[model samples]
Target: EPEVTQTPSHQVTQMGQEVILRCVPISNHLYFYWYRQILGQKVEFLVSFYNNEISEKSEIFDDQFSVERPDGSNFTLKIRSTKLEDSAMYFCASSAGGVHEQFFGPGTRLTVL
Candidate 1:
């Protein structure tokens, strides 16, 4: 069975530093998305990518945040400057299409101090 895989399940960084979270989705999946959930908070959508372009993005995806599909298989989210508030669990998801349910990775827990 195909599944989404993420690297560095947890990360610890300092404020003003940068962090990159990586994910590899099922090969057959098309749509890709990044979402975040602050501790004790609801899940928030960050961005969605399809056909190698950004299909949708939320207000939380500011200039400091960027998403890239570096290769055909990997999707990544980069935060240029980490802030204390950036501490959260970031999830990577993929789906075959709008009609299908999105499959999510285990998530990367980022901690900023």
Candidate 2:
């Protein structure tokens, strides 16, 4: 089965640097999303994008964050200004449609000092 793939399974960064995490979703899926889980917290929805623009974004997705499909197979999440609070497991997900089940990537661990 095709799986969503995320690069740099783990990363360590300083509190004020920029970080860009990459993902490649399943070929036939649509409706991509990004979610984060702080160390011991529940998964929090960050943003959802479709048709090249943001469809929905949660309160957690602020000015520091951005998402883009830079190419046909790559989707990326960039935190322009990282913070200690930004450390978490970021998962990339996609679904065939809004009503279908979402498949998640293994997740990229971002750690800010």
Candidate 3:
């Protein structure tokens, strides 16, 4: 079955450096989203994208964070400057449409020091 795939399973970076996390979601899904889970916290939504535009974003997704689909098959999240709090497991997910089950990627573990 098709599933989302993220690159660089683990990333270690300095507190102020920029980082770009990449993901490739299922081909037929129409909605894409980025989410993060701090160490022991529950998953938090960051942003949602559709039709090449941001459909909605959470307060957690501040000016420093951005998402884009450079092409048909890839989705990406960029953090202009990393903060210690930004260290978490970032996941990429997609759903076919409303009420459909979302498929999530294994996740990219980002570590900031």
TM-score of each: 0.97, 0.97, 0.97
What is the Cα-based TM-score of model 3?
0.97
**What are the clashing pairs of model 2?**
none
Clash pairs, model 1 backbone: none
- C-alpha-based local distance difference test score of model 3: 0.95
**How does residue 26 of candidate 3 score in lDDT?**
94
Each prediction's total of clashing residue pairs, residues at least 3 apart in sequence or on different chains, is: 0, 0, 0
* Model 2 worst lDDT run, 10 consecutive residues: 94-103
lDDT minimum window of 10 residues, candidate 1? 94-103
Q: Give RMSD (Å) of candidate 3 vs. truth.
A: 0.8
Q: Model 1 — TM-score against the truth? A: 0.97
lDDT of 2 by residue, 1-113 (tens): 89999998998999999999999999877789999999989999999988889999999999999999998888899999899999999999988865658899999999999
Residue 50 alpha-carbon offset, candidate 3, angstroms: 0.4
**C-alpha local distance difference test of each model:** 0.95, 0.93, 0.95
Residue 14 in model 3: lDDT? 99
